[model samples]
Target: MKSIVLFGAGNVATHLFRAISNTRNFRVVQVYNRTPANLVPFQTLVDTTSKMEEVKPADIYLIAVKDDAILPLVKELIFRQALVVHTAGAVSIDALENLDRKGIFYPLQTFSKTKKVDFKNIPICLEATNPQDLELLEELAGSISEKIFRINSEQRRSLHVAAVFVSNFVNYLYSEGEAICKENNIPFEILHPLILETAVKATGMSPLAAQTGPAKRNDTQVIQSHLELLTGDQQTIYSLITQSIQNLHGKEL
Candidate 1:
C-alpha cells in the first residue's frame, strides 16, 4: 500500500483523506497542520502533527494548504526520496522545484468538509517533471477517481480561472438572486427548479449556446426594468453582466 502524509486540514484535505481511506491501495498515514487545533478531526484516524520535525517518511507528501502557503511549506519539507505533490489548481508544480520528486495532484472540484462527494466522478489533474513520478500520481489518482487528466501547468492555470467563473462567480450571483427574492417577500425555493435546470442545460451543451434572458436577447426595455428594480450596487453588477452578454452575442437590438 502507498502511504501518504497529507498536509492541511481544510475542506480539500478532509475530503481527500476520506476518499483515500476507502481505497485498499492507498492510506493516509499522517495528517499535518501548522495549527494544533485544526488537526483534532484527523488525530483519531491517523497520526496528526503540528511540528515539521515530527513528520514521518511516506511514499507521498500531499500538500493541501492555501496557494500562498504552498511554497513556504514545501521549502520546509526536506524529503528528497518521496514524491511531493500539492492539491492546488492554479499553483504551478515549480512551487516544489526545490524537491527531488515534485508534481501536482490537483482535484478539479470545489470541496466542502460537510458535503460528501463521489471521488469517482471528480477529475483529478496530474502533472510531474519526472515520468515515473507522473505514473505514480496516476496510480494514486486512479485509486480514488476514474477521471484523470495529465494537464500541464499552463492548462491547469487556465482551468482554474474557468472554474472560478463557473463556480465562485456563479455562487455570488445566486446569493444576489436570493437577496432580491428575500427583499420582495418571495421564497427563494421558487427559484430552485430554474437554477437546477440551468445547471443541467449548461452541462449538456455549450454555456454560450445555453445563454438566455433579457441580456442575451438584448431587450433594452426589459433590461432597464430589471435595473430599476435593483439596488445601486445590484444595478451596476446587472448592467456590467448585461453589457458583457450583449458583447459576446455581438447583436444590436
Candidate 2:
C-alpha cells in the first residue's frame, strides 16, 4: 500500500481523504494542518500534527491548502524525497519548483464539506515531470476515480477558467435568481425543474444548440421588459448576458 500524508483540512482535503481512505491501495499515514482544532477528527484515524517538521514520511505528500499558502508551505516542508503534489486548479506546477519532486493532482469539481460527492466520477487531472511520477499519480487517482487525465499545467489552467464559468458563475446566477424569487414572494423551488432540465440539456447537447429563451429568439421587447424589471446590478447582469446570447446566435436586439 502507498502511504500518504495529507496537508490540509479544508473542503477538498476532507473529500480527498474520505475517498482515498476507503481504498485498500492507499493509506493515509498522517495528516498535518496549521490549526490543531481541525486535525482533532482525523487524530483518531491517523497521526495528526500541527508542526511541519513532525509530518511523517510518506510516498506522497498531497497539499490541499489554499492557492496562496501552497508555496509558503512548500518552503516550510522538510520532506527531501517525497513526491509533493498540490491539488489546485489555477496554480502552476512551477510553484513547486523548489521541491525535489513536484507535480499537480487537481480534482475538477466543486467541493463542499457538508455535501458528499462520488469521486469515482469526478475527473482527476495529473501532471508530473517524468513518467515514473506520472504513473505514481495515475495509480493514486485511478484508485479513487475512474475519470483520469494527464493534463499539463497550461491545459489545467485553461480548464480551471472554463470551470469557473460553468460552476462558479452559474452558481452566482442561481443566487441572484433566488434573490429575485424572494423579492417576488415566490418559492425558488418553482425553478428547480427548469434548472435541472437546462443542465441535462446542456450536458446532453452542445450548449449553443440547447440554448433557449427570449435572448436566443431575438425577442427584443421581452428582453427590454425583463431588463426593466431588474434594477442596478441585476439589470446590468441581465442585459450583458442577453446581449451576449443574441450576439452568439447572430441576432441583434
Candidate 3:
C-alpha cells in the first residue's frame, strides 16, 4: 500500500479525498490548505497547516489546487523526494518541479463543487517525467477509472481546448435555451428528451451524424424564429452554432 497526501480541500480535492480514503491501496496520509478555515473539514486525516514546514511526508502528494496557484505553491514547499502530481487538465506536468520529479493526473470531466462525480466512467489522462512514475499513475488512475489515457503535454492542452467548446460552451448554450423557455412561459421539459436523445445518439453516432435542428434541416423559417427570440449574446451563439451545423451538412441552415 502507498501513502498519499492531498493538498487542497476544494471541489475536486474533496471528491478525490473521499475516494482515496476509502480505497484499499492508498491512504490519505495528510492534507494541507493555506486558509485556516479550509482546514477544518479535512481535519480528521489531514494534519492542517498554513505553514509548509508543517506538511508531513507521504509516498505521493496530490496537488489539487487551482491552476494559477500551482507554480507559486510548488515554489513554497519542498516534497522531500515524494512523488508529486497535479490534476489540472490545461496545465502540463512540466509546470511542477522539473528537477524534483512530478506528473499529471488530469480527469476529463466537469467538476462542479456542489455536484457528485461518478469516477467509474470518467477518463483519467496521465503523464510523468519518469516512466516508472507514469506507470504508477496509470495503475492508480486506472483503479478509479476504467478509461486511462497516456498523453503528452501538448495533446492534453489540445484536449482541454476542445473540452471548453464541447463541455463548458455547450452548457452555456443550455442556459440560453433555459432562459428563452422561461421568458416565454414554455417549460424546459420539452427540450429534456431532445437533449438526452442527442447525447445518446452521439455515443454510437458521430456528433456530425447526431446533429439535428431546424439548422440541419435547412428550415430557414424555424431558424429565423429562434434568432428573433434571442436578444444579444444568445443571438450570437445561435448564429454561430447554426452556421457550424450548416457547414457540417454542406448546405444552408
Candidate 4:
C-alpha cells in the first residue's frame, strides 16, 4: 500500500483526505493545514501536523492549497524530496521549483462542503515531469476515478478557462434568475425543474444543441415580456445573454 500525505483542509482536501483514508490501497498518513480549526475532523481521521516543518515520510505529498498560496507554502514546507504535487488546474509542475518529482492532479469539478462528488464521473486531469512519475500518477488517479485524462499544463489552463465560462458564469445566471423571481414574488423553486432539465439535457448533447426557451426559439414577444419584467442589473444581463443567444443561432431572437 502506498501512503499519502495531504496538505490543506478545504473542500478539495477534505474530500480527498476522506477518500484516501478509506481506500485500502492508500492511507492518509498525515494532513497539514494553516488553520488548526479547519483540520479538526481530519485530525481525528488521521495524523495531522499544523506546522509545515513537521513533515512526514510519505510516498506522495498532495498540495491542495489555494493557487496564490501554493508557491509560498511550498517554500515554507522546507521539504526537499518526496513526489510533490498540486491540485491546481492552471499551475504548472515547475511551480514546485525545488522538487525533482512534481505534477498536477486536477479534478475538473466544482467542490462544495455539502455537495457529494462522484469520483467515477469526475475526470482527473494529470501530468508529471518524469515518465515513471506520470505512470504513478495515472495509477493513483485511477484508484479514485475511472475517468482520467492526461492533460498537460497548457491544456489544463484552456480547460480551466472554459470551466469558468460554463460553470461559474452559468451559476451567475442562476443567481440572476433567483433575484428576478424574488422581485416578482415568484417562488424560485419554480425554476428548479427547468434548471435541472437544462443540466440533464446538456449531459447528452452540447449546450448549443440543448438550447431552449425564447432565446433559442426566437420568440420575440416572449423575450420582450420577460425583459420587461426584469429591471436594472438583471435586465442588463438578460439583454446581453439574449443578444448572444440570437447570435448563437445566427438569427434574431
Candidate number achieving the greatest lDDT relative to the actual structure: 2
Off by over 4 Å in 1: none
| Poorest 10 consecutive residues by lDDT, candidate 3 | 92-101
* True lDDT of residue 45, candidate 1: 91
Check candidate 3 and list the clashing pairs. none
Task: Write model 2 residue lDDT over 1-253, tens digit each, in one string.
Answer: 9999999999999999999998888988999999999998888888899998898889999999999999999989887689999999999999996676888999999888999999999999999987899999999999999999999999998999999999999999999999999999999999999989999889899999988889998888888899889999999999999989988999877
What are the per-residue Cα lDDT tens digits for candidate 3 across 1-253? 9887788889888888876766778888787888889978887766667778877887788899989989888887765588889999989777885546689988888777788888878888998888989988887887788899998899999999999988888788788889989998999999999878777888888887777779889899998987887768988888988898889789964
RMSD in Å for all candidates: 1.2, 1.0, 1.7, 1.8
Error of 4 at 72 (Å): 0.5
The local distance difference test score of each candidate is: 0.92, 0.92, 0.84, 0.85
Error in Å for residue 84 of model 2 = 0.5
Query: Quick one: best TM-score, which candidate?
Result: 2
As a whole number from 0 to 100, the lDDT of residue 22 in candidate 4 is: 59
lDDT value, candidate 1, whole model: 0.92
Per residue, candidate 4 scores C-alpha lDDT tens digits across 18-110 of: 666556677778998888888788766788888877868788889998998899887876665678889998787778876788889999889
Model 1, 1-253: lDDT tens digits are 9899999999999999999999889889999999999999998899999999889999999999999999988888866578999989989888886677889999999887898899999999999989999999999999999999999999999999999999999999999999999998999999999999999999999999989999898889998888888877788999898888988999764
Better of 1 and 3 by TM-score: 1
For candidate 1, which ten residues in a row score worst on lDDT? Answer: 73-82
Q: How much does candidate 3 score in TM-score?
A: 0.93
